[model samples]
Target: MFLAWNEIKRNKLKFSLIIGVLVMISYLLFLLSGLASGLMNMNREGIDKWQADAIVLNKDANQTVEQSLFNKEDVSNSLKKQTTLKQSGVIISNGTHEENALLFGVTDKSFLVPKMIEGKKFHKDNEVIADESLKDKGFKLGDKLSLSQSDEKLKIVGFSESAKYNASPVLFSNNNTIQKLNPSLSSDKTNAVVVKDANWQKKSLPNNLEAIKIENFIKNLPGYQAQNLTLNFMIIFLLVISATVIGIFLYVITLQKTNLFGVLKAQGFTNGYLAKVVLSQTFIIALIGTLIGLILTIITSAFLPSVVPIKFSIVTLTIYGVVLIAVSLIGSLFSILTIRKVDPLKAIG
Candidate 1:
């Protein structure tokens, strides 16, 4: 390690280039991870707000809440106490301006409604509380927003934070309001029944309905699985490339220092001693590169606009940082093996 430290200090610019490559790879990995996490949250923000124990969906709907339909009376009969929801995708218009929104129908006492950031929560059907993003689109409290393809108009009674679903702003109202907006969903048919029973996940019920864990339900949300799959693949690919590049960089440096290693070997430097030189250099480079990368990611997120889906989770970032450094060290094994093959006399000749 002493020899390794001396060489790195003497050739700072060359080592800097090695660190630069890792910095870029690690930056991309962390940035993508943050974006992936952020986008997943955006997809199920409202669902998470519920802190729901389980969701009971129609068996024929294949676990998708949006597709599942149940009659309130039927669900009411099966579960002693439950909150019913009717979700529909629709457009809201203020005549000149329109925005895509999810219309959510919940009973008067349903706990699915998020705490308000401003104004008051809806206490009746057709009166609604919306995600604050709608305010940016020129909506204000007490404004009437019309439902597309229907005569129904929803009054924006309040604004809530982080109440989006599938990346769309939600209009939280009662079951009758949503039923008015979507013809397919009649007044009697709600999309799903939500219950907080402790053993609901394993509960057997009638009416072709079954309860599922909320985590599983969120994972199955439309577009959630596929989008995460693509981003995760990119993260994994960058990790592999990072390891390979770090290994190659260290290996090339080892080649240029072959004669130096040979001279040290002639002076009775053990193979074990030479190996530590490479290992120590590898650890230092990995640590510095990942730190710089994580910092850059945080700085980049700070400058990004609100609309960009990027959220930094220190825990997730730390996990990735550890992984990057571990793999980089594993990669250094290649250069360590190269050091073992160094010959004293033949190389110094």
Candidate 2:
């Protein structure tokens, strides 16, 4: 350990350069991970909050919620089988504030409606709840918001933190109001029903009806699977890049001190002691780089928009940090092998 520290101190320029490379790699990876998570959040934040067990869609639509249809009789029939049903629909419209918006029509029983961050849930006829982020676009409670797509006017009664399916602020409304706005929909039937059962059998479902768990259903959406796959690949690629950069840096540093390590071995130093030194140096450098990378990620994330959709928990960040440390330890093993090839006699001359 002492020898490793002395060597690093003597080669300050080389060590600093190696450490700088590690810092840059770690920083870039952290940024990519945050962006990937943010993109996914923006794409699915609205649907993710619904604590639903399963969603029913039209079998012919092949997993698209928008294409699924439910008449009142079909919906009522499905509700009788021990599952609560909520009518919901998504319609693109121009908001009163003149922004392109997506209206989320959901009944009072809809699970998504109860997550009110401000104001109240959907009530009163023709009244709707908007996402709080839309307030900056000139929306206010009691103000009339128009759905130009259907030429319907709705009263904004409340606002919440829920964003749209694709970053647009969502407007919550009841089934009747949604049907009235878009008369093509039968008021009796619902778009989908959230089911709560582990033993759900899709085979038993009647023809043209499909039951899917939320996770499976989410992937079936047109761009959902492709988008998630792209982000996941980006995160994995960055992680690999970070590991490779750290490994190369350590390997180069170890190669430069081959003769010095050979002399140390002749002077009664055990390989184990030498290993301790190498590991200590690697760990110290890696810890510093990882810490700096995480700090930079947090600082940058602060300036992003609320609707940009980045969801991360303490557990996720902790796991990422652990993975970084583990990869660095694995990378140090390459240098340990170099120590075995040191010829003590060669250095004595």
Candidate 3:
């Protein structure tokens, strides 16, 4: 470690360049990771709020809530405890601005009802709870929103944060409101049934219903699986490419120090001690660079536009940082092998 510190200090420019490369790679990775998480949140954050173990959709709906609809009889009989939900996309306007909203028709006692960040829950047929994003578009508690292209009106009674479906803000209301908005829907039908526990088996469900694990349900959501796959592949590719680049850079620099290492060995330093210096230097550089990169990411997140989708998870970032450092150490092993092969007398003579 002492030799490692001395070498870094004596060759500040070279080590600094290595650290700079690491920071850039780490920054890019963190940014991509954050975006992937955020996009997923945009697609399915509303479902996550339910915290349900699984959902039952019509086997014929092809795992899509939009295409699934069934009467409440079987779900009520098959599961002792469950919540039924009816969802549809509707255009809403605050009289001045129009936007698409995924309207959910949930009973007051249903677990699908999220706690409000402001105001009270919807208890009346026409009262509603909307995602907080609506506030940016001139919405306020008690404001009346009209179902665009129709005469139906709903009053916003509350706001919930990050409640979205299919990248659109979610609106919560009673079945009556949704029924009033879309009279084509049958009175007793629900698009999905949510179960709080994973107790029920697939064979036990109604002949028309299929049980879908929460993860599978989310992944099956239209466009979500593809988006997640693409971003994940990019993130993986970035890590591999960055690791290789770092390894090659370190390998070249180590080769440059062949004479110095040979001199140290001639003075009676053991290969084990020399190997420790190489690893210690790698760890230090990776740690410092990763930390700086994380800081930059945090700062960059603060300045990002609201339109940008990103979520920074402390746990995720910490894991990535550890992986980067570990890989750096592993890469240094090649350099360690080089140190081991250095001929003391041949080089120093």
Candidate 4:
């Protein structure tokens, strides 16, 4: 490690270039990860708040919540022995601003109710709880918003963060309010039922509804599976590319220093010591690069417009950082092998 540090200090420019490349790749990876998480949140943030284990939808709807419908009897019978919350969602335009939003009808005490960031929960028929993102749409506390298809208007009584469904901000209202807006749905009918028990799958379910795990339910959201798979592929590709880049760089650098390594071996240095130096150098470079990339990601996310969909999670970043270091170490293995194969006598001559 001491020799490794001395070598990097002596060849600052050469190592700096390698670190720069790593920083660029890591930055892109983190950014893409943030975008993927943000988009996912936009699509399912409201549902995520429920933290339910399973979602019950009509089997005939073919796994789509919007197409699934349930009658009051079905929901009542299903909830008799299990803890469940029923919710109905619809996408409609805000009558006053002409902006599209997702409206959800939820009971006040239901587990599906979002944590309020400000104001109070819905208590009256016309009162609604909205996503804080609606502030961008010019909605404020006590503002009246009419439903596009119905004469009923809702007053924004509370705001919650990250409350969205299917790329639209979510509004929480009473089931009665939703029935008023869409007369086609009866007051007892809801689009889906959220089951609270993790073992919900083992429990007997109503014949008319099927229990889908929460994770599976999220994947079934339109475009969610495809989008996530693409982003994940890109991230994996970048990781592999980064490893290749590091391996090639270190291998070439080791080749250039073959004579030096031979001389050191002749001077009684062990192969293990030389290999350690190479790995130490790789570790240092990876650490610096990951830190710089993380800092840059933080700065970039900070300056981004509020409307931009980018979410930074510490756990995700940490996992990426760990992978980067591990891959870098693996990349240096080729150089280590080269050091072990060095012929001391011939190279020194």
Off by over 4 Å in 1: 95-97, 136-138, 183-187
Per-residue lDDT tens digits for candidate 2, residues 106-214, read 6666567546766777677678888776776667777776554556678777888756665556777776776786665565655666665565563255666778888
Instruction: Give the alpha carbon lDDT tens digit for every residue of 1-349 in model 1.
Output: 7777787898999889988988998999999999999899889888898877888889999997788887767757555457988888888887767899888888777888887899987877789988887887778888888775788778988998868888888888876777777766787787888877776645567758778888898888879999999999999888888889989999998899899899999999899988888888988888899999989998999899877878789999999999999899888899889989989988899
Off by over 4 Å in 4: 80-98, 147-152
Candidate that beats the other on TM-score, 1 or 2, i.e. the better one: 1
How would you encode candidate 3's per-residue C-alpha lDDT over 1-349 as one tens digit per residue? 8878888999999999999999998898899889999999999888898888889999999998878888877778777568888888888888777888889888888888766799989888889999887776678888888876568788999997767777888899888888776665556888988888767564387678898988888888889989999999998887777678778878899889888888988888899998888889999899999999999999999999776879999999998899888877877787888888889877776
**Least accurate 10 contiguous residues by lDDT in model 1:** 72-81
- Candidate 3, poorest ten consecutive residues by summed lDDT: 197-206
TM-score of each: 0.94, 0.86, 0.92, 0.89
Q: For model 3, what is the alpha-carbon lDDT of residue 135? A: 74
Better of 2 and 3 by TM-score: 3
- The alpha-carbon deviation from the true structure for residue 325 of candidate 4, after best TM-score superposition, in angstroms, is 1.2
Looking at model 1, how many pairs of residues clash? Answer: 0
Candidate 4's TM-score: 0.89
**lDDT of candidate 1 vs native?**
0.85
